[model samples]
Target: MAKDYMPPSDFLRALIDEDVEIEADDTATIKRLLSFFKDPDAANRDWAVFLLGQSEVDTKAVRDALIGALNDEDDSVRAEALVALAQRDGDLARPHVLEALSAEGVYPTVFEAAALCAHPDLIKPLRGWLKATGDKEVDQMVAEAVAACEASAK
Candidate 1:
């Protein structure tokens, strides 16, 4: 006899609840969560995509999906993707984050990306941005990233 499948909302929560127990076998669950990234409901898609990243399952598919989402039209989706990419590979995401920062009207996305970076080298570019644009928030965030990078280096 087969077990009954719960509805998606409940299922997702259940998956999260089971995260600790099944931590070692997240590959399959991550794939299943990735499928929801295309859901019509932006909230569902965003949450699913975010959860997939949190799984931290190292695989080509996960990396591709996160990279693709970094360009998502939705700002939150893009932010989540940037954060995931930062966790996966900070060096790889640096260029894209820097490009976004230089683009006008892209500060929010750029800021989110920079927050994820936590790399000291990002301080140079971020400092340049601060000097050029005089955006205090970005400057503060970059300062925090710099601190984090410095602490990690020690």
Candidate 2:
């Protein structure tokens, strides 16, 4: 049987609770939560990183941390980091996201990263994929991304 696990810090408990509270004002809460990223406990650090991705507040420190997580030893962490970075700065992350998508034996995480980027420049690469491979899923994602970009531009 698996034992029930408890979060170690009051700050973390509050953070997790806040993640589920749609009515909670994200700006103030996310600012407070960002500090936990440097907590002494690895669990706290990881949790902070994960939550930072979900937060609406944008900051240079959060961006740097998420980018650093891209190279983390843990694949799940790396994947989440990529997602956070893409969400935060699709324009800045475009080159890295494209490289990940185009690499041999591309992982689903890489595709997911590209999907989250939703950058206009991605339309070209995604269109090229559609032309070269005729993969319906990739084509559909690219189409959606293009549509989203168009919508945002309007």
Candidate 3:
């Protein structure tokens, strides 16, 4: 959008792609990515959170960064943080997800994180939303969240 808005995720895929070799240290990459969570563009923040969630780094700085993203002004960024936490650390993500889900108008994005975390608490809400929202895309995500939570219970 802007002349200088190079997304923090542009070079990150190279590190995550497996096929692409990382030319720099992983921590540097992660730290750079962490800064994206605060970027002006919501898309950049969302993309950074998504990629960060997929990463396998276990450093404290990374963990703190993801946790900090829950406070983001953009809903999508907050949602992406939840998904990332779910992917990278489900146990750590539960309370935050529950807190976020307690509010209304947080669907679809929240569902993505809940689906990944697979917490049984999400099943009822997901099911209710599945029946309520006629939007196909949202229905799919709700159904997936239900299935994921149901599957985890077993």
Candidate 2 residue spans exceeding 4 A from truth: 1-14, 19-46, 104-109, 120-154
Better of 1 and 2 by TM-score: 1
- Tell me each candidate's RMSD, in Å, in order: 7.3, 6.1, 4.4
What lDDT would each prediction earn against the true structure? 0.64, 0.62, 0.74
lDDT of 3: 0.74
* Cα RMSD, model 2: 6.1
| Candidate 1 lDDT over residue span 58-87, tens digit each | 577877888887777776677677777777
My TM-score estimates for the predictions, one after another, are 0.67, 0.55, 0.76
For model 3, what is the alpha-carbon lDDT of residue 116? 79
Minimum summed lDDT over a 10-residue window in model 1 is located at 1-10
Candidate 1: where are CA atoms >4 Å away?
A: 1-10, 16-24, 105-121, 128-140, 148-154
lDDT of 1: 0.64
Query: Which should have the higher lDDT, number 2 or number 3?
Result: 3
Q: How many clashes in candidate 1?
A: 0
lDDT tens digits, residues 43-92, model 3? 77877777777666666777788899989898877887788778777879
> Which candidate's TM-score is highest?
3
